[model samples]
Target: MSQRERGTRRVVRSVAAATATLAAAGGTLLACAFAAPGAGDGRPVAGPGPCVPGRCPAAYPDPHGGAVVGRDNGVNVFVGGDFAVRGAAAGAEGRVVVEGEFDLAKGSGSPPAYHVGAVGVGSRVPPDNGSPFLRVGGDLKLAAGQRLLAEDGPVNGTVAFAGRQTGTGTVSPKAVRDTGALAAFDGLREELTAASTCYAYDKGVPRKPTGTAVNQGKVTVFTGDGTSAFQVFNAPFDLVAPDGSAQSLSFRKIPANATVLVNVTDENGEARTINTSAVALAGVRRERLLWNIPDAKVVRIAGGGQLQGSVLVGRRSSTTRLSVAAVNGRVFTAGSLAHESGTGGAGGQTIHAYPFVGVLPECGTGPTPDGGHTDTGEPVPFPTGVLPPGFPGLEGLEGLEGLMGRPGAAGPDDAAPAEGRELPREGPPMRASMAVGATLMAVGAALALAVLFRTRSGPGSGPGRRT
Candidate 1:
């Protein structure tokens, strides 16, 4: 062959080899990018165990029980059975909802002084005699009774009677249905139960109660490391103080940022009753403390002692009962709640409803057990928008920022993009991988073009030379 033709053939061969090499290198880079777990390939990444607050969404699986409490703070007293208040001074900071009959006995010598923020009764309700005054936020439902006696002559809120009203209260003919309020009670119960499960699964340590007999005077303390701190007791125990008064339970050796969960159960596969009449809890915040007693039949907080944190009692099949005097936090029971009068201050019981912050199970972020790629073999196009701020696996790619646009900024678009066209709200797992793959492909394309340009311009095709 002529020199020119030979040179052309050699150039062509060189370009072909370069192209092949570029293709292989690109494929290798892509394989490595996706092979690394959580490189942003779309697969769900296992979350860090015991989810951190603010990092998790405030929805179902990790619904920040505290936030739920904050939203439903309007509800104070929620009873699933017949509710009767006789000669007792009970008041709630929020609304009260009773599923069954509600009877409030009049105080002797003077009008009955029972204060409720708002009252929602499902069945029949008796009229108040205006001791402290009835200032309900919503309508009050009564079966048969005289007009509510308010010191100011009439009750502040609306009143609806079932049969007929004989006294001097403004009665509405139609009974307003407060189904949402009742449903909130049910939802709160479910959420608390779910929270109990999450807390137990994430931070609890399974432990059986020690000492054959229950000690009334001695207190039990459970502590834990920074990450997981909990005490799971399979046996039932009572809460009484050392002085034969109230039991004291304390937590120690816990990290400042850690949570404490206490699980209690009885030998008969039921939740043992925990009496907190004279009990005290030290070095524990209501938000960080969780008591999950799914089999509990009764949770009593009587006497004058203070009890803090969230309590989850009873399961789906059984009804959990609650008897309270003074409590510092929220309580969730499946059955009924009885607030003893004259337990707190000056003949009234106080039960504060605070938020409960429970831990959630760490989501699995690793590869699926089947060990297969999530992609359908069809290439996933690289996502638009710059790498998220502080995105992982992207530190080394900072040098290529000029080509990828500013970090976290969408690509140049004069017109506004359509709504919901933005990146995944929950943050895509495989985003970084897609970016790496795209980068590798871009590099390969550039190399291929350069090889072609060099092959066409070098050592071949001058003025003539002969074929």
Candidate 2:
């Protein structure tokens, strides 16, 4: 064909190839997050293991509608005065319901076992096609054919708790922990280590926790009384800060509203004083959050079906689980990686959803109007603040500075990195490849244009022609 046509073909081919390569790369990355094994299954195990009832010490006060359950390890579960086990009774085929200020204390008792805040009458089924039986609440009914999550070998069986459930205050397998109490204890230990280290260093002392003065251990709790009470005990060991400074921790009565600020030197400090909520939340090991679960009561109305509820996946909220305390805020179910979770807390309302957690979906009514008054330094209508219809209002002023542009101007060169800006140490090969690709594309374009000009000149081309 003509030279002009040949150059055009070459340019088209290169562009097509590049487009295809980019598409393939994007597809692979997307699959990794969405299609990976156990990624889309979105299932959870069963409730926690049986709690070993602990004997209250002489220092323990009389039970005023409260109970204290301790673990062999440094863990304790305190059932508050207001805390009540709803739904089922012991040795019955029903769901065990927990609500209202259940305290999970770690490293308070002996033997160092993790304490379960609240446990129902149930155990995880082994890999045998045995009787599909589980202990739960009195109100639970499994329709014609329903089953709990159980192990049937390597793969999961029909009782997969990963999907949805049915019933009033229905407890699905999604909220269950597969590994049982042993796994819970391991998780508790890991949590203490991670939380303690984060708290110690964040307080700005040295870096790590000093094992001598303060062993960064925690308590596993089973039951708790919401009332303010104290327990006295001598640590077989001493507690130390990061700087190797020795200090003894007082096993005093923890206040109802006042949370334990582990790293703070000032006892008078409030929650606002701490920059990271992670630090503030650390004090209350057994705390509840509010999550406005929509269509949750519908599950009960339909005798337990796969009802839709919004989940919030944030830093602090996502890590927590729904407990008795959270029931006051809203009907809480087991949360997944895709949604938020929380437990019951103080001022527990049976209708309100308490203790928000994770990344929650927006579903609010009414369109937030953008009144175009932004010129007067008025707040711009943030798209994030507007929730979807039927969603609870989760709008709070966050990331406003970044959105305002005072911190980062629109210009590329003007926008400097906040702190560390690491550049590639060596990039000869990458630079060369990019340079070659750019040069080739530019040259191809120029040649194509030249060919077009020459062809248009019609056999008598004089200028804009290459020999």
> How many backbone collisions does model 2 have?
95
Task: For residues 1-467, write the lDDT of model 2, one tens digit per residue.
Answer: 84444443443443344324323333222222222222221111111111111221222121122322221111111110112222211111111122112111111121211112122211111111221112121112222222223222231211212112343232222333222212111111111212222222222222232211224433111122233232111122212333433222222233443322222221111111101111122232222211111111111111111111112111111112222111211121221111111122222111111111111111211111111012121222222222234443323311111111111011111112235633233365345334433443443344334434434443221111113
Please give, for residues 109-200, the per-residue lDDT of candidate 1 as tens digits: 32244444322211111122221112222334332332232212222233222222222323322233333324222222322333333323
Indicate which candidate wins on TM-score.
1
The candidate that wins on lDDT is: 1
What residue runs in model 1 are displaced by over 4 Å at the alpha carbon? 1-89, 95-111, 118-218, 226-235, 241-245, 269-271, 277-282, 316-324, 342-346, 360-467
RMSD of 1: 23.6
Q: Residue 260, candidate 2: how far off, in angstroms?
A: 0.5
